[model samples]
Every structure is written in structure tokens, then in C-alpha cells.
Target: MTTRSSPGIAVGVVGAGSWGTTVAALTSANATTRLWARRPELADEVNEQRTNTRYLPDFTLPEQLSATSDLADIVRTSDVIVMAVPSHGYREVAREVAEHLRPWVPIVTLSKGLERDTQQRMSEVTIEEMPGHPVAVMTGPNLAKEIMAGQPAASVVAIDDPRIAGALQRLFSTPTLRVYTNPDVVGCEVAGVVKNVIAIASGMGLGMGFGDNTRATLITRGLAEMTRLGLALGGELGTFAGLAGMGDLIATCASTQSRNNTVGRRLGEGESIDAIVESMNMVAEGVKSCPSVIDLASAAGVEMPISEQVVAVCHDGRSAKQALVALMDRDAGSELG
Candidate 1:
């Protein structure tokens, strides 16, 4: 197994989606990065062409980056393993990785969402599947296409261990990408998951032709809900106001590149949830995470009205306009309430 002290720290990223490929490309600039694609053909393309044509066609990956279809090949050789699979498949992939992962190799998850069945964070799933490995989460206002285009962006690496967190912040940082380390893993993960749900609500407002006031209201209230739930789960309050919370929330809600926002806009534009999901090539985490967020909120005795409306629209088949009316009709209360 490669070591951090070694000249070449191998980074194995186990996903080939747009965000995964972007991260692999970023890490390849500093480490011997290998991306795992489930499809052999996609691996071949990344190896031969240095481009993920299906997911990230417009950007070219670094020469140092390579692609592999064998999960074990990547897991067995790496010093640090990045789990980039979607939340739904995250546990299964972590289990598969554990079968061949080198002892003590840090596992960093880039997927943002809660597990539907277990309602567990991806880091929790990682710990359950592969104990003794240092678990971390990398998240922020990261948009794949923009980052691939070499735009300046920042992210947070949340882990309990200061040493491991420092190592990851350095490994994932690029010339244009700044990485910060935080100890509040729970806060960062919760912020990342809940923002996607809120982004859908923001997009719904946009699609319904609501003014900026409505969007602003959704974002502000969503942050409150996110902070409340995070605190209930033992997360630090400051973490919610940091890059992982308010920063990520704004980007996902306003950016055109956000998958969850796109899904919500489509829903607002009169498309059925099924049809919107069927048409997208990528996973919009908020759709699956909506129900789980509501569940978590209810368990914590937190009222997440926006997430509740999102669940209704995505699952209960409520119209976006109806959701809007319902929200506006609610009894007025203090802003802090």
C-alpha cells in the first residue's frame, strides 16, 4: 500500500460521474490518481482520451489520471480512497471496497445525501462497512463543470482527526481550488445533504416565476432548518454558517449546474417527478434525500417546512403552485422561530 510519506500518494476515486471525474482530475494534478468507472468502455475512454465523454465531455482530464473498471485494483493499491458513488449505492460500494481496501487507508466520501433505507450519513455507512479506516467528507459549493473549467472554488474537508483532515485538505487542493479542514463532520455532512433539498425548493420558485424575494426566503429559512437539525445531531453551530452550510446552500440553489435545482425547476414547470428523473443522466440527490430529510427532521423534533413541501411534490404528487400557496398561507411567526 502507498503511504502519505511516499513520493507518490495514490488516490483511488471510485466513481465516474461528473463530480467524481472532476475530483479525480483535480487530485491527479498532485497525486497518482485513478478513477474507477463501472463501465469498461468509460474506463477505456478516460485512459485513451483523458475525457469522460458521457459525463464531462467538455473537459479534458490530466495526463496523470488513469481509469480502471476493477474496483479491487484501485482499492488495493491506494493510500487514500475517495468514495464518489451516489448515496443510494454508497453502502454497497463501500462494502465492495472493504473487501480489497488496504488497511488504514483513509476513505473520503464526496457523495452528499442520506441513505434512504437507513437514513444514515455516507460517513456513517463508511464506518460501518470499513472500521478502523479514517473517514472524511469533502464538500462545499462545488459545481463540477465550473470547477473543470478551472474556476476558483473552495471546499471543506470534515474529519474528526486533525492529522487526517490536514492531509486530505492538502491532497484535494489545486491551484484554483482552496480546501479547508473542519472537525465537525456531522455538521458538514448534514449541511451538504439538506442543502440539496432546499435547492429544489429554490428552483421551484424560479420555475414558477417567483421573484428574488421568494428565493431569498427559502434559502434563509432552509439554513435555519439545516442548523437546527445539525445542532440536534451534535454538530457545531458555526459549521452551519461556514462554507459547508450557507455557502453550499447558496450555490446549489442559485447555480444552473446543480442537478437538484434542475430537477426542481422541471417539477415546477409541470413535469412529473418520474419523467424528470427518467430524463436526467445523473442522480439528483435531493429527490431521493427528500423523504429521508423529512424523516430525520421529524425524529429530531425539527420542523422543516420547505423539505416537507419538497417531499410532497416529489413523492406525494402535490403541485408546485399548491406547495407555494400552502407555504404562504402558514401563520406568521418570529423570524427566529
Candidate 2:
């Protein structure tokens, strides 16, 4: 059921979606890396042909990368684990892996959404399922398709502990991929989750035929909301200005490839959230995250006007046209708020 740990560093990336596969492909070159796919067919495809056409169409997987349906092999063999599953599946998979992981093995999460019912952050969920294992979050403007294509990018690894952060940084860094370590796990994860919600709003502006001026204005205001919430939850202001915040916000808001933005555009074009979600194989986290984010803001006494409007449009059946009109109708206030 379990293989002996590699004498060298071995990394296990859970999930075989675009991001998971890409991370495996990248790290496999530096160390032994294995990707865990839920579907045996996808695992077989990756091992046999070095391609995951279902999720990563037209891209070649690295020759060093291998995949398996067995979570046990990964837990037994890996020195570290990177979780690339969607938020909905994060806790369940973490619980299962905990049964097999050795004590103190570091687990890094790439999930960028909050838990819906509890509104728990990814690290919080990990602690619940795998107590005492150091947890970190890797986030930035890094896009999966771009990274898989070997494009250059930088990202931050956020852990409260410095030593663990540095080790992860070295393990993940490559010629094309630069990794930075920050102690602001709170800031990084909070910003990572909220930016997806904001990108939806930005995309709605794009779909409604708004120009650059309007899009820029929306992104700026959205950043204001994001910073406000991040500050209340023990995050640094400087983090908000950096790559995990503004850089990530810009990419997700502007890119046609962003699933969240794409969903928002479809919403703007008069499609129902149910229909849009039904059609897509990938997860657009903002659609599920909006209500949870709004709840968190309410609990913190912070006002997130854009996220509230997104929830109304996506869940409460409020028309996108009406939502925009409503946002415009809000009482005038200080620019900072």
C-alpha cells in the first residue's frame, strides 16, 4: 500500500486538473514528483502518453512526471505534498491523506477559495484534518496554462514559520519559476480568495461593454475592499500592493482564460449561474465563494459592495443589469471606503 520514501526529495501533487498537473510537471524535473488523479483513466493517460488532454488540452506533460490513482503511494513516498484540489474537495482529501502521511510532513495548498459553510481558510481546514503538519499557501498571478507552457512566473509561499517557508521555496524554485517566502500566510490566503470574487465583478464590467477606464476604476475599488478585509484579519498592507494582491487581481480580471472572469462574463451576457456551472468542467471559485466572502465581511463589519452585488446576481436571481444599476445607486462616500 505504501512505497519507501525516496532518499532524495519526493513531492506529491494531489489533483490532476490544469494547476495540479502543471505543478507536478514543473517539480518533477527537480525531484521525484507524482500527481494523483481521482480518475484512473486520467492517470493512465498521463503515464502512457505524458498528456492530460481532458483538462490541459494541447499541452505536453513532462517526461519525468508520473501520475497515479493511489493516494497511498503519494502519502508513503512524498517528503512534501502540494494540494491542488478545489476547495470543496480539500478537506476530504486532506483527511484521507492524513491517515498515511508521516508526522511533520509539510503540506502546501494551492486552493484559492474559502470553505462555503464554515468560511474556513485552507490552512484552517488543513489543521482540522492534519494537526501538527506545517501548512503553507502558494499564490500569485501565476496561471496554470501559462506555467504549463513553461512561461516565466513568480509566486509567494506563505507560512507562519520561516524555516519551512525557505525549504519550500528552494523545492519549488526553478530557472523559469522564481519562489519567494513570506510569513504573511494570512494576507496571502485572504488576498488569494478575495481576488477571485473581485475578478468576477471586473469581468462583468468587461462583458457589459465597459472600457479600460471603467475596468481600471473597478479593479482599484475592488482592491480597496480586499485590503480592508485583509487588514482586519492580520495581514500586511504591503502584501496587498504586491504580486499576491494587485498582480493576481489584474491577471484574473483581465484574462479571458480566467474561469471566474469567464463565468462573470457569461453572467453579464444573461446566462444563469446554474447553466454556466453545468457547462464547465473546471471550477470557477468566485461563483461559490461570493456568499461566503460576503458572510465573512459581515462578520468582520466590513463592507464589500461589489461582492454583495455578485452574490445577488449569481445566487439571488438579481439581473446583472439591475445589479450594476444598484451599485451605481449606492450612497456616495469617501473614496477610501
Candidate 3:
């Protein structure tokens, strides 16, 4: 593990939202950290009050972590840039950063959702925008609030380049944060995207007031669906059992802190999707990721019943109960099948 005193490394975090702010706080032990927010006022708040009132309210930021709204300044100062923006804005953000990014500066994607229009994963979006640059994906059961509170957490950093993965492992592996490296970028990306869809399904279970038994079943079946889709896309089967797969599935589905869960809860309460989204300024990734996941599954010839139900509920206005009934009434088959 690389200590805060590690030399010759500076970190820049893009996006000043909850996850981005949390990443900044987690790495603040290293003095050379800069957080980029599109809003200058939010940046000033981080620099002056040491708190991100907009996203992570009431949590104090570290003094060592400075904030900026200038992409050029971020690119000029940091050796490693962490992309923490929402999935929808990922491509635009990557394009903006590409113009200013220094050569060979490794970019790590911390976003989990797939692009709705293109159905591309975060790493794919990054590679398209910034070709030839070293790209890595950091994913797992990482909750920004928990990480900021100094809780023990583990995550996988997937990169084909061992050196790039090792560098990230060194930079991000603090005493409270355990970082693992994997070569299955495809597996990691697919798992990361599909887990959010399952999280919505899990949330619907919660909304329906189901007990732990139902939750467990949804999560297990969700994992199966994720594995099938991932393997069909050339991902390693074991990757679905790791941090980016079942781990993320459990965390996001069970926690109220998850945007997808919140969306599902609201839907259960009879709130319209548009109203719920408009009221909450943040993005609920599952709502955006559902259609894309279904598309990907169809294209890859993978069976994803839970994901399909989520897409119907979120987009087609099917009630959560109806979706669950549909899933339960499906033709019975072997669990492994």
C-alpha cells in the first residue's frame, strides 16, 4: 500500500458530487489533491468552509484537499485524474478533459452506470474519447459516505496494463481502503453496469415490504443474471463473484444511500418517475441504465429477467408489484439455467 507520503504523485478528482467529494476526502492524507467542480461556488465552498454542502452535506472536507472549477488547471496539476461524474455526462466530461489532459496521465473511472444512448460502459466511453491513454475502472461495494467516514472498504481496479493498475493500487490503497487489481476490464464494466439494474429490483422488493427472504432471492438471481450477461460479453465468470459483481449488487440494492434504491422506494410510494427525479437533484443511475442493460443483454443473447422487469417498471410505467408478479410467473427452469 502506498502511504500518504508517497512521492511524485498528485491526484485530481473530477465532479464535485457526493462520490467525487468523498474520493477527495479519502485521499486527503496526500496533500497534493485537487477536486474539480463545474460550479465555482461549490468549489469555493470546499476551499473555504471545507464542506460540500451541495452533495455531501454536513461532512467536513479535509484541509489538504483544494477545489477548482477549471479543467485546464486540474489537468496541468495532477498526474492521476479520477473521473467521478454521472454516467450520462461521462462522455462529454471525458471529451472536455481530453483537450486539456496531459499525455500518459492515467484516468480512472469511478462511475458505475452504462450510457443510455450508446449503451457504452464508462471505460469504453473513456477509451473512445481519450485513445492510447491508460484507463482503469474502480468499482465494487464502495459507498461514498462510508468511505469518507474512514470505514474499511475494498474495491477492484481493473486495467489491462498491470503497471497502470499497480500505480492506482499504490495511490488509492490507504489503510482504510483495500484495493485489488483485475485484468478483466470487460467483466468489471459489465458487472458494474448490471448491478444497478438489480439494485432497482431489490429496492422494489423493499418498497413492497418484502422480508429478507425475498431480498436474498432477488440478489442471488440478480447475480446470476449479471454473470450470464457478463460471460456472454467475454467477461470472466469469477468476476461476477468479486467486488464489482455480487458485492456491488448487495450494497447498492440494500442501502437507502443508493440513488437507484431511492428511485424504487419513491415508485413504491406512488410517486411519478419524472417528479421523483425532478425533486432530487441527483441522478438515479438505474433508471438511466435499465434500458441500456436490456439492450446489451438482447444483443449479447443473455437472459436477464430481473433487468427486463426493471426496464419495464422504470420506463414503461409498470407498477413494482406487477413487475414482481411477472417475474414470479415466468416459466420455471433450473437455477443454473
Candidate 4:
């Protein structure tokens, strides 16, 4: 890891999607920040227009930030690298960059959602691909559009090394962005992945025209399910109360801006998953995450009723009403139970 005594450091961002562009824009303290995009044309546009018109339409990128299609140049120049690609692409992209990355260069992941086949978190994929490299995750109630607009936001940086987390806190922190550090890497990963499933459930409630009573119940119960699954997977309970957990869940589940929520709303409005997915160019992570989350909960012997219902509705063609009925009819128990 390129350890620096000061806060300002060189950073590399891999991925040119909305989230990546937003982070690159927010972390402008870096003397030289390179954003790696797959399309050369997109990089050129960003460099010339001072805006990622396709991804982040409204905000202009800083002149100090450079966009590139070359991973070699980015990895060679960056002191800290961030992977913001989707979870499905995590392993492949990490392995591709691993060959060029300097040893011990701290890698921060901003991707949420679990691997469909491996059921692994983004950090797990990173470790498997780049052995002995330090890894951390950044997550919270961050909406890309809001952050791009310079809205005040608070986020958590979870890493195994306190020093690394502290360094990252200084690197990414801005006047509008408050950054906190934590050592519970597993807890952070679990919270980031599982909350998408809950967001899907919450979106279903909204689409069905459910009232505040129903939404409140879903949020509370969703937190319970998240905590149960997190604990079963060996995560700390307090982590669920922090940014990666409740903070992320609230932003995702309650907002129409969330891709997962948008997917669920479309599903509730009688659109087929195939049709909905085909209409949008961007990925809706919850649709892909549902089955894997269900599988993980099953294997862990943790009852995730909300997640299970979401999986059934999305994958099995179960009607939203029917799924809700089945959930309500489950054997009753105490609120805590």
C-alpha cells in the first residue's frame, strides 16, 4: 500500500457508471485521479465535455480528473484503487487488474449485491482474485444523483486495518461528505448486499399502494431479517445499525431513485421482468441478487421471509398479492421472535 503521511493522495476509479462518476467527482482532492471506462469514446467525451453526459448528466467533472479506457495506465499511476463495477463483474475485473496492480495498494469496493453463483461479497471476490492485497468497502445512504449535486451525505469506510480506513477517511471526505471508519469488514459487506433484497420488498409495498403503516412495518421487519441473516453469517449486530445497514436500507427502500425499487415498482405495475430489464440499459441489482440471497439464507438456516417472498415473486412468477398473503399466513410468533 502506498502509505502517505497527508490526506491528499492519488486515487484510481475503475468503472464509469453513475456511482463511479459520482465518486470520482467527489474525491477531487487527489492530485491525479484517473477514471477507467471501457469505452474510449466515453473517456474522450468526459475529458472534453467536463461531464459524463451519459452517466452523470448534470454535474461537470473537475479538470484535474482524467478519464481513460486503459487499465494499465490507471493501475500504474494510482496509489489507491476503487472498484465500482457490479458484483457479477467483480471477479473478472479484479483478476484483470490484479496483474498490473502494485502489491499492497489498498482497494476500496463500492459495489453492493452478492455474487449469484459464488454467493460471495465484493470483498471476497477481491481477495480471491488479488491475494495479499488490502481491501475495504464504502457504503451508506448515498444516492448518486444527490451526491453528484453536492448534497450532504454520510458514509462508512469498513476495512480490516484501522490505519487504512483512517487514510481512506481523509482521502474521500469532503465538506459535504462525512466519512466514518469501521473495522467490521464482513458486517459491512453483508449489510450492503442484503439491503437490496429488502429494498425490493419495500418497493413492492409502494407499488401496491400500501399506506405508511405497511411501509413502516416492512422497514422494521426488513431490518430484523437483515440482522438475522447478518448474524447467521457471523456479522456484528451493531454493524447493521450503521451506515452500511439501516442507512443504506432507508435510502434504497424508501426512494424512487433506487434501481432496485424501480424494478420492484415496475414488477408491481404488471410489467414482466424480461420487459422491464430489456427497457433499461442499466442493471437493477436486486433482480440478480434475489436468488443468491435466498440461497445464502437457506444454507445458513436463517429465515428471511421478506427476501424469500421477493425471490418467489421475481423468479417463480408468483403474484405480489399471493406472495403477501403467504407471508401473512405464516405461523405467527412474538414480535421479537
Candidate 5:
């Protein structure tokens, strides 16, 4: 266990959003954790009040968790760096961190979506910007508010290196939070990206007043879609059935706290995408990731009807009802296809 008794191995988390702040708080229990916020005011609030007013306003941060606006300070000093920025800003922040980061420090990406234009996973972006440094991705059925509220939860830390994966599992684990390690970085990352898109479809079903059967069908089919693309991209089959895949899909699709689910619900309830986006404070990754996911599926020659409809609804201004119709109108095929 790399606890505070160790002299070094400090954890630096970039971004002060709800998930970043929550992760910073979680790592502080095991190591000296420092968080970097883009806005000076948000950093000041975290340092002075131990709270991120805009993001995790309801939860109080651990005293051991500190905040800073200077990216270089944390980049140069910390032993481990966790990039928690959203997918859109992920590459930019990683490029900036590369300027001052030490040669061998491992970087963990907490973002769950793929790059918009490049369609690259967050870890891939990190590897491109900072080659030779070990890169890992931490993802699962974790909800920031529930984790911060002390509800028991588990997460997976996927890395190509077994030693680093095990070390991160210990670094992130707590009494209430259990961390598991997996060597399938590709599987874990693909699962994380695809589940958000499926969640949006599930939310549309719910908002349209569909019952449990409808939700179940969407989830099952969504899992199949996810598995196909994952395998096409060289991911393991078992990964889609693990926490980073099915577990996360269920949680995000069913929970009201999920931003993507909420956005889909609003759309099904007759709201415009522009209005929904304008009204929210946080990014709903599915809204932006939908198109990119479709592109990847096309490139892989995989059929993802649900994701296609979601892209239509989110980007092409198609109605949620129309999307459901389009899905149902497709020719039925073998379940294994």
C-alpha cells in the first residue's frame, strides 16, 4: 500500500470538476494529493474553504486535499498525475502537462469519452503527446456525488503494465471504495466510451414512458453493440461483461445523476438539444461522443443502430420518437450478430 507513510508518490490531479475533485479527495486518503483548477477563483475556493462551489458544492473536501491554479507546480512536483479534464480539453491539458512533467511519471486519464476529431481514446491522446511515459485509464460505474457521499463502490484501473496497475489500484482504493486492476487498457477504454452513448438511448426510453422491459432490451442490445466494436478494435470479450462495461452502462443509463441520461431524457420530453446544452453546467459526453462513436463503428464495419439513431437525434435534429421508430424498423437478425 502506498499510503501517506511513504515520503513520495504524491498524486497530482488536473481539472477541478466534480470527478476530478472527488478523485483528488479519494487519493488524499492514501497519498499527498494536489488538485489543479483552471480558474483561480475555484482554486482559491478549494484552498480556503475546502469546497468546489461550482462542481461538488454539497460535499466538503478532505483537509489533506489541496488545490492550485499553477499547472507546472503540480506537474513538476507530483509523482503521479491524473488527467481529469473532459474529452474536449483532454488533449490540450495533456500537451500542456507534457511541457513540465518529469520523464517517467505515470499519467492516469479519468475522462470516459473519445476525442471529437481524432476519435482517439483519452489514453491514446496522452500517449501521442507524452510518448514513453506509462499511461493508464481509471473507469467504472462510479458516480462522483455517490462516491463523495461515501456509498460503497468499485472501479477498475487498466494499464498495460501489471506493476503500475496494481500500484494504482492501491493508490485509489479506500475502505469504502474497492479498486480492481486489469491489463486490458483497450477493452476498458472502449467499454467506457460506448456505454455513455448507450445510456443516452436508455434515457430516451425512460423519458418516453417506456417500462422495465424496454430498458432491459436497450441495455442488452447496447452491450452487444459495445462488444462488437470492442472486439473489432482488439479488446477482450470479458471486458464488456466487466465493471467498466455492463456495470457502468447500467449505472449511467438508470441513474438520474448521469448528465448524458438527463440530456436524453430532456430530448425525449420534447426539449431541443441546443436548449438542453445551454442550460446545463457540465458536459454530457454522449452529446459530443455520439457522432465520433458512429464514425468508429463505421470504420470498424460494425452495425450500431442505436448509436446511429442517437447521433441523428443529438446532431441532426431528429426527434427522439423518430429515432425509436428508425431502430424498430430495422430488419431483425440473429442475437449473436
Candidate 6:
């Protein structure tokens, strides 16, 4: 297996979505990064054209980066593996990676969703499949297109071991992209997943023509529920105030680039879930992660009113307008309660 290059470690990124493609290209500047695409044709385009046209249209990738369709090639030829697949594909890909993955190579998850049936976080799902491999999550307010456009951004690398987290922090860190380390993996994962759900609510408000005050209220109150659930899951309260929580929430809620937000906007504009989903190529994680977040909140005995409304709109066949009315009519309580 190929190990470290002169300056940085070799990285194998599985999944060639917009975020994955952007990350692999960015990492290629400092490391030998290979991105794996599910389709051979897509892989060939990335290899020959140095671009993933379907995912990151009109964006050019670095020459140092490569693409492949072989999972074994990635697992066997890299020092580190980055899991960038959506949550729906995480397990199947994890099982495949496990068969060929080396013992010491750490796997970092870039997914921001939970397993539907298990309701387990991305890091937990990785460890379950690859028991001996170190698992970590890399997350923040990173919009793939913005990063690809070379706009400066910061993110957190969360893992239990400070040493491993530090090593990864350096591997992903660039001059324009700063990577911070956090030992609270739970908080990071929870924040990453829950923010998408909240973004949907925020998007619905935007589609319904709500003012900035309404948007601000959803964001602030959504954060409260996120912190409460994260705390119940053994995450640090302070972690929720950092990039993975507040930063990510703001970006997803406010930015038009977010897929979850777009889905919510369309739903609020009177599009049915079936029609919207059928027309899209990319997965809107909040649509699937909504129920799982509700499940987690229920298990923790926390009241996530916004998340519950999101679930109602996405899954229970409730109209977006109806969900908003229900949320607004609920009994009021203390801000911190």
C-alpha cells in the first residue's frame, strides 16, 4: 500500500458527490488523493478530464488527484480513507471497505446523516463495520461549491483521541481551509445531522415569505434542541456553540446551495415529496434524517418541536403550511425551557 508522500499522507475518498469531489481535489494540493466514483464512466471523466462534471460542474480538479471505480484499489493503496458517501450508502460501502482496509488506517466520515434503521451516527456505523480502524468525523459550515471556488473556510475534525485528531487536522488543513480538532465526536456528529433537519424548517420559512425575524427564531430555537439532544447523547455543551453546530446551522439555513434547504423550499411552495424526490439527482439528507432525529430526541426525552414539525412535513404527509401553523400555535414556554 502507498503510504505518506513527501509532505502529506495518501487519502482515498469514497463517493464522488459534490462535497467528496471538492474535498478530494482540495486534499490533492497537499496529498496524493484518489476519489472513487460508483460508475466507471464518472471515474474516467475525473481521471481523464480532471473534473467531475455531473457533481461539480465546470470545476477543475488538481492533476495530482485521481479517480477509480475499484473499492479494493482505494482500500489497499491509501494510508487513510475518507468516507464521503451519503448515509444511505455508508453501510454497504463500509462493509466493502472493511474487507480490504488495513488495520491502522483511520477512516474519517464526511456524511451528515444517520442510518435510517439503526439511527446510529456515521462514526459509529464505521466502527461497527471496521472494528479495529480509528473512526472520526470531519464537519462544519462547509459548502462544497464555496470551498471549490477557493473561498476560505474552517471545519472541525472530531475524534476521541487527540493524537489521531491532530494528525488528521494537519492532513486536511490548507492555507485557506483551516481544520480544528475537537475530542467531542458525539457533539460534532449530532450537530452535523440535526442541522440539516433544522435547515429544512428554515427553508420552509423562506419559501413561505417569512421575514428575517422568523428565520432567526427558527435558527436560535433549533439550536437549543440540538444542544439538548447532543448533551443527552454525552456530548459537551460547549461543542454545540462551535463550528459544527452554530456555524453549520447558519450556513445550511441561509445558503441556497444547501440541498436540504432547497427541498424544504419546494415543499413549502406546494411541491409534493414524491415529485420533488423523483426529479432530483442529489440526496437531500434532511428528508431521510428527519425521522431518525425525531427517534433520537424521543429516546432522550427531549422536546424537539421544530424537528418534529420537519418530520411531519417530510414523512407524515402533512402540508408544510399546516406544520407551520401547528408549530406557531403550540403553548409558549421559557426561552431556555
Cα TM-score per model: 0.98, 0.97, 0.97, 0.96, 0.98, 0.97
Candidate 6 residue runs with Cα over 4 Å from true position: 1-8
The 0-to-1 C-alpha lDDT of every candidate, in the order given, reads: 0.93, 0.88, 0.87, 0.85, 0.92, 0.91
Pairs in clash, predicted candidate 6: none
Weakest ten-residue segment in model 2 by summed lDDT: 1-10
Q: Best candidate, lDDT-wise?
A: 1
Query: What TM-score should be assigned to candidate 1?
Result: 0.98
User: How well does model 5 score by local distance difference test?
Assistant: 0.92
lDDT of 2 by residue, 55-155 (tens): 89999888888999999988888889999989988889999999999988999999999999899989999999999899999999888898877788888
lDDT value, candidate 3, whole model: 0.87
lDDT of predicted model 2: 0.88
At residue 251, candidate 6 shows an lDDT of: 97
Residue-level lDDT tens digits of model 6 in 1-337: 2223465467899999999998888788767899999999999999898888888998888888999999898889888899999999899999999999877899999999999999999999998999988889999999999998889999999988888887788788877899999999999999999999999999899888887998899999999999999999999998899999999999999999999999888888989888988988899999999999999999989999999999999899998899999999999989977
With candidate 6 superimposed using the best TM-score fit, by how many Å does residue 103's alpha carbon deviate from the native? Answer: 1.0
- Give me the displacement of residue 292 in model 1, in angstroms: 0.6
Q: What ranges in model 4 sit over 4 Å off?
A: 1-8
Task: Report, for all candidates in order, the number of backbone clashes.
Answer: 0, 0, 0, 1, 0, 0
Model 4 TM-score is: 0.96
Of models 2 and 3, which has the larger lDDT? 2
| Clash pairs detected, candidate 5 | none
Q: Model 3, range 193-298, lDDT digits (tens) per residue?
A: 8888888888788888887898899899999999999999899988999999989889998899998888887776667788988999788888899899999999
> Candidate 4: lDDT of 75?
88
Task: State, as a TM-score between 0 and 1, how close model 6 is to the true structure.
Answer: 0.97
Score candidate 6 by lDDT: 0.91
